[model samples]
Target: MPGQETDRRPLSAAQLGVWYAQRLDPASPVFNQGGHVDLHGPIDVPLFAEALSRLVAEDGTTRLRFTEAGGVPAQFAAAVEPYVPEIADLRDTPDPEAAARELIDADMATVPDLEQGPLFRHLLLRLGEDRLRWYYRAHHLMQDGFSGHLLQRRLGEIYTALAGGTESGPALGPVSALLDQHDVYRDSAARKKDRAFWSRVMEGAECPPARAGRPALRIAREISFISSEQFAALREFGVRAGVSWQQVLIGAGVLHQHRRTGARDVLLSLPVTGRLTPAARRVPGMSANVLPLRVAVDPDATCEALMARVASAVLRVQWHQRYDASELIRDLGWPADGRRQFGPVVNVLAGDAPPRFGGVPGTAHLLSTGGTAEDLGITVTDGPDGGLRVDFTVDAAYADSVPLASHRRSFHRVLDTLTGDADVPVREVDVLDGVEWGLVVEEWNNTAVPIGQETLNTLFEHQARIHPDHTAVIFNDEHTTYRRLNENANRLAHHLTHCAGIRRGDLIGVLHDRSTTFATTLIALTKTGAAYTVLDPDFPDTRLNTTLTRNHITTVITDTNHTHRITAPHLIHTDHDTHHHNHPAT
Candidate 1:
């Protein structure tokens, strides 16, 4: 405690990343992390408060205050008063649970003042005689999801000892211990190696497909749980395939992205607990780093092969997981332009189990995990009933733009596929369920309508009779009335039949520019009961010749400018005067 207030140290790389993010949007509470623990049976509120205070005093991270020292962000342990839980007797209110939830939400929405000392809050609500809810909220710069669980476990240990009239376990190590460990690693040769490994992994990588909306702090969450039977099947499959369930989940995520976006190479942010050293693990501060797992999916390969690939990538990432992702971004020269390097985050929360409270039945419920930089996050954790729970936190700005329910269903279908046949090809895995399939393939594609048997030429003639003086064609600032267009087409048809011996069922080639003459030629050909093949003037001569020969077209109608491009045995120029005399007046 000698340098408690005076000793200022540079933030750890993880904390520094969060510091910059918070500074970018100081007023947004998107960086606030919060959760609540519902205790079914609890009584000693006073003892609980004392235990929390003692825990706060022992953990140096709880007393940390951040400020800019010499124009650089630094953190120091402040000798502040011990943190006390704000007790609320909500038992008398109508719907005490609802009241407590509202309180927690309001506190989580508050933006913490980084320089003003305390960056965390504790609230204890009494719902009934035996029911209680304990809420905790902290800034991301102070703690992460792992640290949150650590603090809860330690607090439970202290509270249990106090209640049992026994000595508590050893206290959490000081924050400086982790800080020193980080400093040593930062300047170590291993750091250089990590940088190189990450550089190689991220080489030739581009940002994931852009999401629907801009980056916003507010989020919409959808929570669902996998059935115990399905989870069991998944675990069994993983075991037989020699991979962990976590890897299977990650592979499923990659497959989902591939199926969703059709991107062969998919990138997902995998959150790694940056507790490489014992000190970093024991201190319980901000020690989480996100690793970009780039999975190259081969659609032709089996799902088992994809899982093996994912497992290998995950193992490699775990080996080099100490490197901070923010540092990697800076080293890679990626600008902070709000474009995400990875798609949805595939987070596997396998370790942070619910903390025990003096043999009391308590359930942990996460309220918020701060604002997500990525548009979507997929969190997989152990469900309450021996199953797996998946929570999707999507950007609120894109909640309407994105299909959350459909995505959930798609991911579930992927999980089902993984749990069933390992030999299924990646491309053959169906993401959509039957209902979604119907929507996409049947309902959405329902475009059929009854149609008369009138041919194109007859329809045009009917329209011309009804609107003779109306403009029927407009090209290059010239307009032709329906009557004149019909007359011209009739004359051309008569000329083709009488002079060129053109008859029904003949395949005629129309080689012309996109002009009124082309329209006239098509109508004339249709009037003669002959099918016309369009030969673009822009096409090469070889292609034109191929089209004519392939269609067995001996006669072709062309304009004066394009007459040389046609290779038909006989050619009739639209501008030629020879055919004009053969046609009768219409």
Candidate 2:
């Protein structure tokens, strides 16, 4: 990869994570951005081409799969060639967008790269004979926010080295070795302890605040932002109350939902940075995972009480992020086949570091909350001034109406308690808006169906009613009917309670895979009025044993064909017909 100069630097690990994330998100503009990348500057075309080739060659851990390893579907260089002007005289147009328009009409955008990836082509606009700003517009498949940063940083360094007559560059270290090393670490004994740590945090988990369906949240064209004075006041209040900015925001987020949907129990899916371990922090990819923090408050719950619960849940989730999102979902027994059950998420990544190169004068003030559920997302970015810029993208159906606006205002007031100090606990702030107070009060008085309760089981039962016969359990050639589902559940219930001494208040733990018995056991446990815990067989034996001991589980009902092999008082294999229904002495 040689032209004449410059060995470029590569993207750091954290930046690369964000880059790959955009690749996976359908809603991301990056999903269709690859076709629009254009490189413009006053440098030798051959030199820049070589620079780009070198940039791709440096081999950031994640990019190699799509770059040089014979792994991706197409050559990135070829897809990019069309975007380069054959021989255009360079000067800045009054608007960079004008150049963008011409390039799109040129049909260079249709070219594909990396198989499924779109072409990453760019038009070189000569800027002052020495510098350039590569006007980039590419589908996310080619690059993400972080990848762009990596490219710019490395390109600048490469150009600088070339100008200085350096024939060699700093060789790339064992970067390619990181992926396999990480995989090995993931399956290691240390990872087992980490998994156990997370399991403890999610022991009695619940889903977060979300609307039932996929109806999109309304996004406003014209948005008036909160003032600096208002944000300051909130910061002061949060400090006095003893919670972080996040707790304060979460409290306010719950209030917004209550005002918008009239639901009270706040189950917000808050995103946490998934990079926790020392090793994880070094390799960057989309490592943000979420946790469902349950905030149970009556319509009359003071800001203080609500904030406290949200804060505690946030702490535990952060401490246990090692178990990634996929692991958390399975442990929670949530469906992953794309029928969305998880609620809307609230993410705050306020650090000011967008993609920038040495030539660019100022930093690119990019504020994005990556990919999120089609629910209400409250993203707080570092504002132009010292204040915070908070963007709330709600599902269009739940637009901020009059009542919702008032709830939004009241939430800001809670932040008012924080203006004096940057830190204040969420619970200390008070929501005293008369209209909002009365609206929530009326809902509470009119019916016991409080707003918070709706955030939980209310919709679940309705889903069951609507889709009862829709393949509740699909075991090998044996589908359990919703009707028969409950009957088999009762049979298991009688067997557990009467024969195995599992009573109304007992906790029965089932080690399982996705099967009819697992579903039936779940139903039976519900019927018997006993709480049951599900541990995937993939979980380490030690971890499962810890849950058993912690929950005081005496009987573990699993099948012999699909088993835990752990000892219990009565190992009742479902394959056996010796199902007894006699009640054991309580």
Candidate 3:
């Protein structure tokens, strides 16, 4: 592909918008695991420098040298010229490890000093002979673990290309157009279709799903495959088994964490890049959104079978991506209240490392960071150098990072065994590490609030003493008196219990409103020890009937106005029947 590589050019507005939004993600650097990288021996200076230059050029955002604009996005460059330390007489430092530690400290400090702009991108530091550290504090935005690793891969490719006597640079396209992409997103088929869907979804609804107002000081972690070779086999195996690489990973996570924690289900706020169009290069805000997948597993389900189920369910949701997620949540009657409504998120980033920049002979390590609510995340990267590195970020309180690190190694073993025995049941794959078991068990055995709490009730009532003799419901030129309404309620309650087979805990479908008949039905149901759930008269009858069936609503109590729409075995109406032996009007 590099043989067809194109030279660097400025990003079009659309590409710029996308990069701007991504790099400027205010909630990035989501992970906090950074350490020194010590080469086994002296580094190749010429090879490294050439690699850096080519990499900076390929990504566009990195090619920039700072100008004194004080901010990155406001202008396009840094506030000052970058300084690369001279490594000629660096003998005073103990060794590469000590030097790397110093480099990290300096990088951390400089990160905060980066004034939300260009200089924060990264500064390449040469420690001494055979040692190098790229130091610069990065907000979780400009790059993520997947992208970082990709960038490194690209860099190595470019470097190797240069080393192997090919310096013209990798092929390219116009700088990706991010802003145009955003504009296109605004007018895209999905956007237009979703707008209509959202309006209808939210029409006349007061209560909506709830969320915590503030972003918590968050920490996350992920355990992914540690062997590129095994991952490759897993890839082939996943295809043959009709599952995605991501589902395989998610299944692995569920198995690893559920078995240890005894959790039968888990909720994950999966993030989607929302890169659904060429215009995806436009609008740079949080194009990334979270989809809460409420996944549950039957205890008796084997890993292979469960994986098949998970894959299908996951694909179904993703395929229906045209719906407004917020609307879907409301329509599905999910909890809007911010009480960990579903569960913590688990993400699978197939990783976006550059696609083999020039095909290099080096390894790239990527550590993903930030997204305030990511409780746990897993990122997979395919380095050109034939290696796989797994990074972990965990809630400090839940488990030890060391254990996760240990499992990363053990997962490699599991991967190998699974791949070696493609037909082997997933559970039979040897799990050498106890920590992996613990995490899985904890995930499978959840402690979230039960179903009853999730779907709750809220009642509102008031007296008209505030407005004496006020008209409540005006129907067919007749006004219903609140006092009179209350009286009818008492009368109906007696009749419903004594004649209409009403009892405690029974759900009475109340198809009414502020209408006089509505008030009466609500009060009547309460007396029978029954709860009345309202169904808006204007809503489709099919929808209303579905609710009735789901809630086991036996009595459909309405006025004569609804006779044509609802005809159940037990339909009770007022005014239509007067003296017919008023034996409870059944």
Q: Highest lDDT among the candidates is held by which one?
A: 1
Clashes of each: 1, 67, 66
lDDT of every model, 2 decimals = 0.80, 0.50, 0.49
**What would the TM-scores of all predictions be?**
0.73, 0.50, 0.51
Report lDDT (Cα) of residue 429, candidate 1.
91
Instruction: Identify the runs in model 1 with alpha carbons over 4 angstroms from their true place.
Output: 1-3, 209-214, 351-353, 400-402, 438-586
lDDT of 3 by residue, 1-586 (tens): 0111222223322223323433444333332322222232445665665556545555534323212232433324332233332233234566755655565655543333223344234444455654455432344433333334434545555656765776644433222343245455556786676556545534433221233133333454554545566667777767766787778766666555454344655544555554555433322222344454545666565556767877865664564343435445556454433222233344665444333323322333443343333144444544334544455554443334224555466555655654675556544655655664566577556657545533211121234334335665565557765555545666777888887878998877776544555555676677677877887764556667777878777778776667677656688765432222233355
List CA RMSD, all candidates: 13.0, 10.9, 13.3
Candidate 2: tens digits of C-alpha lDDT, residues 79-125: 22222223344456665455545754453324344333433444444
- Clash count, candidate 1: 1
- Model 1 — TM-score against the truth? 0.73
